[model samples]
Target: MIRAADPSDAVAIARIYNQAITDGSYATCDLKPVSAESRIDWLKQHQPPYPVFVWENQLGEVIGYSALSPFSIRPSYRSIAEVAIYVDQAQRRGIVGGRLLIHLMKTAKKLGFRALVALILEKNQSSFEAAIGLGFQRVAYLPEVAKMKQQWEGVIWVQKDLTASSQ
Candidate 1:
């Protein structure tokens, strides 16, 4: 099931995120594991229009999660959001991540966001293709701007128009 996240979901969400951070890190630029306390604080930053959602099992365990965050510090960019998704390593082969992403897009639209963007690692082909298939198009690329595991890597920014009504 998918639902808006609350403070109690922090630990489970943190575990899923930390797995992605340590496993290969193609999923996120953040390298180290974050504490639930930190995630609680992070969760507070998201208000009405921008929110975080978690994919939970019948037992209420969070297996995956996604969110829309402020794209920039400037108010002019408030209409744009940076989207992210993460799935537990144990549950990866399923459609969990895609479902969470779709849910985020829907929520973003309902809240009147103008656009949703994803800054994806160039090497993460699955995420890139998935975002493209979901109607996001590449807008820009930062070449070798970050180094992971001693190797330089690039990132691509893809965005979807949220103004259009969904089919």
Candidate 2:
């Protein structure tokens, strides 16, 4: 089941996210795992207007999560949102990420968002393809945008229109 994340699920979310960070699929450098308290504080600090959702398995575990944050602080950019999706390493290739992203897009549209964007590491082809499969277009490629482990990596910015008229 896919639903809004709760404070209690922070621990599970942090565990999954930490796995990604450690595996180098998420962050290129090693980082300490985030605590449940921090996750709960984040949930409390940003709710509704900015949404965070989770996908739970039959066992009621958080297997994946997705979120939409303001694209820019300017008032005119209110209709635009930047999105991020993450799934448990064990849950990858099981469609969890796809499902969570679709939910995020639907929710974003319902929230009156005009555009949804995802910034992906150029080397992460799976993520790039997934975004395209979900209707996002490759809008830009930022060369050597970030350096990780002494290697420079590019960033691909993908976008999808969420307006009814866009369909």
Candidate 3:
């Protein structure tokens, strides 16, 4: 089942997120792992309007997670939010990330977001495919914007216009 993430879910969430970070996943470009305590702080930053959600197993273990975060710190950008989803490496075949993205899209619309954007690694075709499958369109590409593994990598920004769905 999927539900809103709380401070207590930090440990499991951190473990899953760290794995993606270590594996150079498309969610982020970070190369270091962070502690649960830090994750708690991050969770705290996302309050009611933009909350984080997690998928749990029957045993109550967090296996995947997603969130809708403010796309920009400026007040004028409140209608746009960023999407984030991470699934445990051991649970990839479960399609957890796809489920999480679907959840985030609904949540974004419910929270009055006009659009949801995902900044994905250009080289990660699977992620791009997943986002497109979930209704996001690749709107822009920034080439050689970040360096990782001694090579310049790019980011593709995918966005879903929420208003289009209601009309």
lDDT of 2 by residue, 1-167 (tens): 99888888889877877886678784323356777788888778666689889999999888898889888889999899999888989889888999998899888888989999988888888899999999999999999978776788898999999875754
TM-score, structure 2 vs. true: 0.92
* Quality of model 1 by C-alpha lDDT: 0.89
Residue pairs that clash (backbone atoms under 3 angstroms), model 2: none
Lowest lDDT block of 10, candidate 1 = 158-167
> Candidates' TM-scores?
0.95, 0.92, 0.95
The 10-residue segment of model 2 with minimum total lDDT is 26-35
- Output the worst ten-in-a-row residue range by lDDT, candidate 3: 23-32
The order of the candidates by TM-score, greatest first, is 3, 1, 2
- How many backbone collisions does model 1 have? 0
lDDT of 1 by residue, 1-167 (tens): 99999999889888888998889949888877899998899889878777999999898789999999999999999899999899999888689988998899888888888999999999888899989989999999999998888889999999999887572
Q: Provide the global lDDT of candidate 3 against the true structure.
A: 0.89
**Candidate lDDT (C-alpha), each:** 0.89, 0.84, 0.89
Residue-level lDDT of model 3, residues 1-167, one tens digit each, is 99999999999989998998887665678877899999999999998788999999999999999988888989999999999888998888667889888888888888889999989988888889999987899999999997888889999999999998452
lDDT head-to-head 1 vs 2, winner: 1
Comparing 1 and 3 by lDDT, which wins? Answer: 1
